[model samples]
Target chain A: MKSEDLETVRMVVHARSGVAVDISKEYAIESRLAPLARRDSFADVGELVQAIRARRDEGLMWSVTEALIQGETCFFRDREPFALFRDDMLPALAARADRPVRVWSAACSTGQEPYSLAMIVDEVAPRFPGLKVELFASDLSERRLEKAQSGLYTQFEVQRGLPIRLLVRHFEKVEEVWRLSQSLRQMVRFRRINLLADLRALGQYDVIFCRNVISSLDPALRGRVLEQMAQALAPGGWLVLGQDERPMGLTEALESISGWDGAFGRNPAFRAAA
Target chain B: MKTCLVVDDSRVIRKVARRILEELGFEVAEAADGMEAMAWCRTAMPEAILLDWNMPLMDGLEFLRQLRKEPDGDQPIVVFCTVENDLEHIALALESGADEYIMKPFDGDILSVKLMEAGVLA
Candidate 1:
């Protein structure tokens, strides 16, 4: 692809979704977008870029931007966070006078993270007695949101980071694919959302899982998103970042909860309570 | 290195599994079927057993049942890696003394992680 094309695509992706594309990884970027070009009947990436530069097709802009956005997610991508959700977060939220605990999976990619959260809630719901947990998942890509709502996963996806025991329990074999049971699918509602937009209208959540998301944002947007996410959390609600991530001095509203990896909260009492 | 018995009817699966298990630092052994696995276990018990379901001359579940009767059979961590994917199948394997369950089409990472979960590897 031409340098101008590369720059244009990178800028569009970064501007739209806050995902910064590394110029050095041009080969990876081309490989990911090549299929999109072919699917759209473009002979090659250069022609695709030519079309994109003309800005004739408005849909292609979103397609390329969505394609360029990274969507690497699987069931329970990291194990420790889910364990904390099961043992600590669920109990704390259930203890609150709030009837239905609200959880948001921001930039949730293909829905594995939120579905995993729902599975945990379903497993422990009997103990809570009339427990109601509302799960909301969102991503920038509409295609990915559709797949997430489908509740289908490949054999490899079901096994990756997911305990196989839960695989048979929560998912049913559908020919070559595995579909997460309908009840679990109903537990999550997916939406096409941009993190850069106003989020207050979505209301507050008891737990917000924004793992591996804001870290990918351009430096300017990180602080803005961090503060907005902080405001969106219910009082004493936890914000779980990526496993290896910290707030990095972006915002003072979040403080790390000791022993809970990648988990932060407005209230310091989360540690004492957990 | 700790010893692990790799039992499967498929030569290709056994070969692939042996490679991955060896890569995870296990001294690997192979058995074509349950009776053969049983015969091998009587002489020298391995620290771990990767059993496959639906093998000839006795299947994994029966082998596990028979193995539990042996003096130190319960010592080896039994993990069934097979294509038999159902809640009942997994539950039965656990009820029959298996330590772990991995569905077929596995990779090195899957084997390494499952073995670690079984407490057979650090």
Candidate 2:
């Protein structure tokens, strides 16, 4: 792909999905789309881009967008954050409010985050007895969201991060692949959400994990996206960011906690503004 | 028989490690998360712990930090078994008092070798 064409696709992806693609990673982008390009009988990504610009093929455009978005997710992507959520966050949230615990995995990209959250809640649910916990998972890509809803993972995806017991308990192995049980699959409600857009309609959440998805936006867009996130977070609710991502300038309502990467709201006033 | 505590939130991982440890002749105990692991530590007093980095309640790092504060800080050989494959993350785990670091999707042989090196297995 030419540098100009790569730049154009990057801009379009960012504008539509809020996913930032580095200019240096043009080859990766081209390789990802090469199959689609060939399927459409285009010689290369350059021709594909030309075809997309003609606005004659909506299907090709969707395919290109899907190709650009990295939906590479595995169960329990990072172990520590989930650990924190299970040990520190969940109990804290349970104690702070008498209502049902609500969690939103924003940009949940293929459902790993929410499904992982559900597994944690499932493990602890017996202890809580009557406490209700609802998990909501959303992504900008409808294609990804549909895959998330299916709760099916290939052997490779199943192998990473998932423990053997969970594989046996929550999933059934069909040949080499694994499919999540209905019980676990039903725990999360998957939806299509544009994080850069208004999120107030989604309602409040006790914990929001918008990890790794926001770093691609411009700083102003990042701030606006976070503000929309802040609107959905309940007071004392936790926001988990990517390892290198910072929420410092994102929202004033959140105060950085000692150990976790991002901040927590000590006061519940932030969501009240929603 | 020697005893080892496998402290991880993932049941699949715990089971795999337990099988490997048990095959190597160590009796294995398990905890679903760090808090449960801490509770087990108070009573079980296992000779070693195979910890996972990310968990729901208290993560392995926080658990290690808290465990090190106890009076019996040096009681167990704490080895972090996790998917945080970055070298810097491994260094951080060691700096946090983890006796050894094992990355995830690990081979059973590698696990056994690490256990032997840590003296949890012969």
The numbered model that scores best in lDDT is 1
- Please provide, for model 1 over B33-75, each residue's C-alpha lDDT reduced to its tens digit, 9 standing for 90 to 100: 9999999999999999999999999899999999999989989
What is the docking quality class of candidate 2? incorrect
Model 1 over residues A63-182: C-alpha lDDT tens digits? 988888779987777677888999998887778745788999999998899999998988899989866889999999999999999998987777776766677678887888889989
RMSD after CA superposition, every candidate: 3.8, 12.2
Off by over 4 Å in 2: A56-59, A261-263, A266-274, B1-122
Off by over 4 Å in 1: A267-274, B9-12, B43-45, B85-95, B116-122
**Tens digits of per-residue lDDT for model 2 on B1-122?**
87889988878888889898888888899998899999988776788899999999899999999888877967888888897655457667777888776767776766765665465665
Q: Which digits, one per residue and each the tens of the lDDT, describe model 2 over residues A176-232?
A: 456899999998998888887777778888899888876766666776777777677
DockQ, prediction 1: 0.47
